[model samples]
Target: MSDREPEVVRRLSSYDVTRLDTAITVIQTRDPALARILKAERDVLRDHRNQLDAFATRMKFGSAAPWHPEGVMDWLIAQGWAPPKGLLMAEGEQEGQVDR
Candidate 1:
């Protein structure tokens, strides 16, 4: 992954299903393995969304937004990719934080 957002991921996140299908088709041509991995990732996200739906019901709130279970860098790391550490820090740069 680059410093910039992954365009395929962006398109997959789009509200339009046609765009998502097109993005998936294009991504498969470039990196078939990654496309498969992302499909699995999407499944995981969908499962989390289901859980969040239940959570929201029990808590009496609106449906919660879908979220990744781990950080972006964590996913990259698992993929054997190393993203720049400085970019991984949260806002305000809390003191004494070394490796998270």
Candidate 2:
């Protein structure tokens, strides 16, 4: 058997899932490895989210917190990720029009 413990792998997997979920919710794109991990455990994560409120609750906090989607995106942009244009678009009904 390998010297590495199984618990270590479990913890890493949990951390990876959390990161992927945050990426999907905030950035709408998952890191390549994270995307693979998410795809492999998608069903399990969905079931867990449905059975417990933790995931949903955390999402609410992240969405409402001052340092959240925008903050994350800004930080990522600083790290070289391209800023998403949708982040700058206004919500709700549009007013006025621009002539070409």
Pick the TM-score winner.
1
Single out the weakest 10-residue window by summed lDDT for candidate 1: 61-70
In TM-score terms, candidate 2 sits at 0.23
lDDT of 1 at 53: 56
The digit string of per-residue lDDT tens for model 2 on 24-83 reads: 565436466666566567656655544345434545668878657766565456546675
lDDT of 1 by residue, 1-100 (tens): 3588755433232244344456678899899987887677666656555554544454444224333323433544764667676656588775467865
After superposing candidate 1 on the true structure, give the runs of residues whose Cα lies further than 4 Å from its correct spot.
1-23, 61-100
**lDDT for residue 4 in candidate 2, whole number 0-100:** 75
> Candidate 2: deviation at residue 75, Å?
0.5
Worst 10 residues of 2 by lDDT: 8-17
